[model samples]
Target: MKKWAIYVVLCILTPAIVKAQAVVADSVHMTSKKKVPKVQYGVASFYHNKFEGRKTANGEIFSQKKLTAACNTLPLNCWVRVTNIRNNRSVILRITDRMHPLNKRLIDLSHAAAKTLGYTGHGLTRVKVEYLGKTKPVELNLMEQPAQP
Candidate 1:
């Protein structure tokens, strides 16, 4: 009878024990706030082909087709406008990961962004990046306004 009672108690307490362990594990991954720079100018590069499916710093799967970029210190999930200073082409990308610590570039672009900016051939480009804050609705001037009295 005592063995049966102990087994019941163990079953009742197991879920709470597992939940507490989960909380502890998640706490270790918490990231502190990071400030985004208004504008930055430097050499930019792209994510290499080997890291296509790896996990990014923000916990998302890396996808070269997405308009994403990486920075050393910018806040995750924020958007930035990257312009190729050579051809004056620009594209907006989200900060979804971090650049390699040993990398000396200012920002790392996604493969698609590099291709769109006409830098895939060179693998690196001189670029200007402007922080656009977090993703938000973009207002368009072409929308028809209400008629005024």
Candidate 2:
């Protein structure tokens, strides 16, 4: 009877011990690397009319004409600088919404913001973005990264 009890206790404790070990390993992996956020450049299109006036992830109604953008990991009410390399033009947009659920792009700009960069169709454009290190009320200004060929 004592041996049976011991075996049962071991079976119960083993999983908990293993789980603790896994948690420690995961913590080590997360802490060992510096998390530098990399900005991605790609072909992005704006959403308007359909999504305008609708509630955004930031709990504000989306506006197609606003100088605003949606980002995945950027905190709400941070500013981001989006630049178009082809024309050397850029727009400073407040991060007023979260990223699109199905997209891997860094940001989703409003229609007016996209127009600032002269993007009309789906094609690759050189872009550089930097997160403004502030929170609400957002300061929509950031230094633009030099265009990469």
Candidate 3:
């Protein structure tokens, strides 16, 4: 009789326990998902000729010929797509530096980037900056190794 009672209790509790676990698992999965990318819209300007060789916030030498940018909010080394709203031109640039504390622009692009977006002459243009996540580090495989020295 005791065994019958224990079996009845388990049968009544099993479905409830499984359902609760499923709910918990779903919540965990939702929390583990990656966050959505961020997007911003504002005016964008390019670096001056005097800033061509200076060191950026990320310790990289600033180059006007490179497709890089300085952003106030985005993380360094992340890639973003900057679109010129006036001419509908777009360019992908890496955020390798930070803007000044008082700078109100959305992003400061390199001269090459601004030229590619067709806004070099205008100096500043309305832009849409979309975060494209961080750049991945290069991975090396065993096959690519230099072989036992």
User: TM-score of every model?
Assistant: 0.69, 0.60, 0.66
Error of 3 at 133 (Å): 0.6
Task: Please say which candidate is ahead in lDDT: 1 or 2.
Answer: 1
Runs of candidate 2 with Cα error greater than 4 angstroms are 1-43, 121-124, 135-149
Candidate 3 per-residue lDDT, tens place, 3-117, comes to 9999999999999999999999999988975554588999999998999899999999999999899987887898888899998998877899988899989899999999999
Instruction: Report every candidate's CA lDDT.
Output: 0.86, 0.74, 0.88
Q: What is the lDDT of candidate 1?
A: 0.86
Error of 3 at 40 (Å): 0.4
By TM-score, highest first, what's the ranking? 1, 3, 2
lDDT minimum window of 10 residues, candidate 1: 136-145
Measured with C-alpha atoms, the lDDT of residue 69 in candidate 2 is 81
Instruction: Summing lDDT over every window of 10 consecutive residues in candidate 3, give the lowest-scoring window.
Output: 135-144
Please provide, for model 2 over 101-145, each residue's C-alpha lDDT reduced to its tens digit, 9 standing for 90 to 100: 788676778988888888856534667877654552233222334
For model 3 the local lDDT of residue 47 reads: 93
**Clashing pairs for predicted structure model 1, backbone only:** none
Query: lDDT per residue, candidate 1, 1-149, as tens digits?
Result: 99999999999999999999988878865653445579989999998899999999999999999989999867889888889999999988789998879989999999999998999999889999988887642631223356669
